[model samples]
Target: MSLKVEFDEPKCVAAGQCVMVAPDLFDQRDEDGVAIVLDDSPSPDQYDEAREAAAVCPAAAIRLVEG
Candidate 1:
């Protein structure tokens, strides 16, 4: 199993929810606090965390694609 994480910068609201939920996969920029994807493809074990991060995003900026 493989998981892919996608971050929509323009849709992000700097909420930091994704970072909080999955720090290993998501981060926030220091300048404007925009969300950034640290790891687009995370290990299978991290799939749950990735999904939680996407679900917690208030702006719906995080997307998780399973393959």
Candidate 2:
């Protein structure tokens, strides 16, 4: 199974929860503080962290899709 991380920039509320949970996969822009997806396709071992990041996002901007 492969995991993909999707981020909705428009829906993001500049919350850093995703980055806090999964720094390797998520980040915040230096200027606006909007969440940035560092890795859209995460490794299998990082699947749990990816899911956690999505779950912790207050803005519901993060999504994990399995393909």
Candidate 3:
């Protein structure tokens, strides 16, 4: 199985939790502090961190799908 990351920009609140949990997989735009996904499909080694990032997202803008 593999993981997929999705971000709904309109729902983002610039909380930065995702970035804090997984800096290598997520980032924010300098223009407006909106989240900018760095990796949509992270390696297996990063799955835990990526999952945590999605969990910690206050805005609930991050979605993780495994298939």
Residue 21 lDDT in candidate 3: 91
RMSD of 1: 0.7
| Sequence-dependent TM-score of model 3 | 0.96
Candidate 1: which stretches are off by over 4 Å?
A: none
Model 3 bad stretches (over 4 Å): none
Cα-lDDT of candidate 2:
0.89
**lDDT digits (tens) for residues 4-62 of candidate 1:** 88888899999899899889988899999998999999988888989999999999988
TM-score of each: 0.94, 0.95, 0.96
- Give Cα-based local distance difference scores for all models: 0.89, 0.89, 0.93
In model 2, residue pairs whose N, Cα or C atoms come closer than 3 Å (at least 3 residues apart or on different chains), thus clashing, are none
Q: How many residue pairs clash in each candidate?
A: 0, 0, 0
Candidate 2 ranges with C-alpha deviation above 4 Å: none
